[model samples]
Structure formats: C-alpha cells, structure tokens
Target chain A: MYKVKVYVTLKESVIDPAGAAATKEFKNSDYPEVEQVRVGKYIELTIGDTSKNVEEAVHDMCKNLLVNTEVEDYRFEIEEAAAK
Target chain B: MYKVKVYVTLKESVIDPAGAAATKEFKNSDYPEVEQVRVGKYIELTIGDTSKNVEEAVHDMCKNLLVNTEVEDYRFEIEEAAAK
Candidate 1:
C-alpha cells in the first residue's frame, strides 16, 4: 500500500483568522515565548496496490476538492506503507 | 529558531465524519483508485531561542490546547529552521 500525506495551508497572501487567534491565545496563556503559529489541514490517504498513475490521481484530488486554490495551497508526500 | 510540526489526528476508536464524506466523494468522483482517507490538523510553531526546555514547552502546548485528549492524538517533529 502507498501512504500519501497531504498538507493544505492558507496561501501566504491570505489572512488566517484561526492562526492569528491561536497566536494571541498562546501569548495570553503564558506562552509568550512563541514567535509564530500556523494551522492547516493534514490528510492521510491509504491507497491500495494498483496499476493506476497514483501521482496524477492525487494531484487531481488536491486540485479538485482537497484544496481551495483561490485561497489555499497544498503539497503532498508519498511513501510505501510498512507491512502490517 | 526551532520549527515544530505537529499532527493532531482522531483516535482510532473515534468516528470521523469528515473523512467518511471525503471517502464517499472520492469514490463518486471517478477515483475508484482511492482506498481510505483520514483527516486531521497540521500545525506549525516557531519558537525563539530561549533557556526553557523546548520539548517540555511543546508538550505542554499540545496537551493544553493543540489536542483534544478525549478524541484526538498528537505527535510532533522538531527541527532547526532554515536561515531566512
């Protein structure tokens, strides 16, 4: 099996309210040592052994649904899954 | 600077509605190649150089806010940030 890890994050030009709130919350919670905080979506996909072009399939997945291209950017890492 | 990458995922026993929906959507979207999908949160934290124990501080942050121990599990990878 193949394991694909996808990270969907807001574009640098976009404002992230959730991230800003978390930063403020950390500062107020006595974690004044923090410099920055960013929050995003992490998705893991388990792909069954197949002959299909996995890379193209995943790229389409991200572009079509997993990510909002208008405001978010996404990247993925692929690896073989260890034997169960 | 220290860069911390945190992944917060639902416990195995917990049912993930968002994941289920995504799985169904994939199946219908001509991507029968998909097997399974799990969704979670990805967080990045930047910490300034300090005398405090970095690992301990991050652990506290995860336990106090980044994770919901009742339903989610979290793990972190820390590394030195690249010079900007």
Candidate 2:
C-alpha cells in the first residue's frame, strides 16, 4: 500500500478572514505579539497496492482532479506493504 | 511573538467526499494501492509580542475563535524577540 499526503492553502496574496480573526483575537486578549496567521489544509491517504504503475496513477489523479492547482499545493508519498 | 498551529479535521465517523474522490481516482488511474485519503486543515500564526500575558491571550483566542474545537485541534508556541 501507499500513503499520499496533500496540503492546501490559500494564495499568499489572498485575504484570510479566519486567520485575521485569529490575529485580532490574539491582540485583543493581550497576545499582542501575534503578527499574522495563515491557514491551510492537509490530507493523508493509504493505498492498497504497492506498484510503480499504481503510484503513477495516483499522482496523476492528485494533479488533475484531487487538487485545485490554481489555489492549492499538494505533495504525496508512496509506501509498500502487505494488504490489510 | 508567538506561533500558533491549528489542525482541523473531520471526525473519524464523518465522511470525506474529497478524500473518497481522490482514492477512486488513484485506483482508476492504475495506482490501485491507494487505500484511503483523509483531508484536514492546518494554520500557522506569528505573534509580535513575547510576554506571558500575551501568550495567554493568544492561546485563548485560538481556543475560542481560531479553531472549531468540535472538529479541530490546535497547539501553540511562544518566542521572545526584539520588535521587527
């Protein structure tokens, strides 16, 4: 089996309200040192098969469909293991 | 300044459609080894001040507004430095 890890984040230039809120709260509550906050996503997947062909297929899927390349970035890893 | 890291994920029982789709794509593309995909979010924040009171405030902000405790988990660290 293989494991795939994906990370997603907003474009750096984009305004992150959630992050902003966190920053504001931090400052207001006395944590004035907080400079900025950025939020993103992470994904992990376990695959069933352990073969080069299978890994290639999974990579393509992540590039074309699983990730929104326009705004998100992702990376994946593969591992071999006995079926579970 | 302080750094806050937040991780948000679907509850174990919750279904993740995005993860499912990624899995299906992996299998269909010939990467059948992919077993599953679980996606989550991550956040990082940098704070400006380095004081015990400030750290406490930032921690509370993260707990109360930065993260959805029901579906998210978070941790933070504090650092001392000259203002930049």
Error of 1 at A21 (Å): 0.5
Q: Model 1 chain B, poorest ten-residue lDDT window?
A: B27-36
Which consecutive 10 residues in model 2 chain B have the weakest lDDT in total? Answer: B74-83
How well is each residue in B14-59 modelled by candidate 1, as lDDT tens digits?
A: 9999999998888888776677889999998988887888999999
In model 1, what are the clashing residue pairs, if there are any?
none
Q: What is the lDDT of residue A30 in candidate 2?
A: 48
* Winning model by DockQ: 1
Off by over 4 Å in 1: A82-84, B82-84
- Clash counts per candidate, in order, are 0, 16
For residues A1-84, could you state the per-residue lDDT of candidate 2 as single tens digits?
Answer: 655555567778777887787667666754555678787777777766443575567567667767677776666555555666
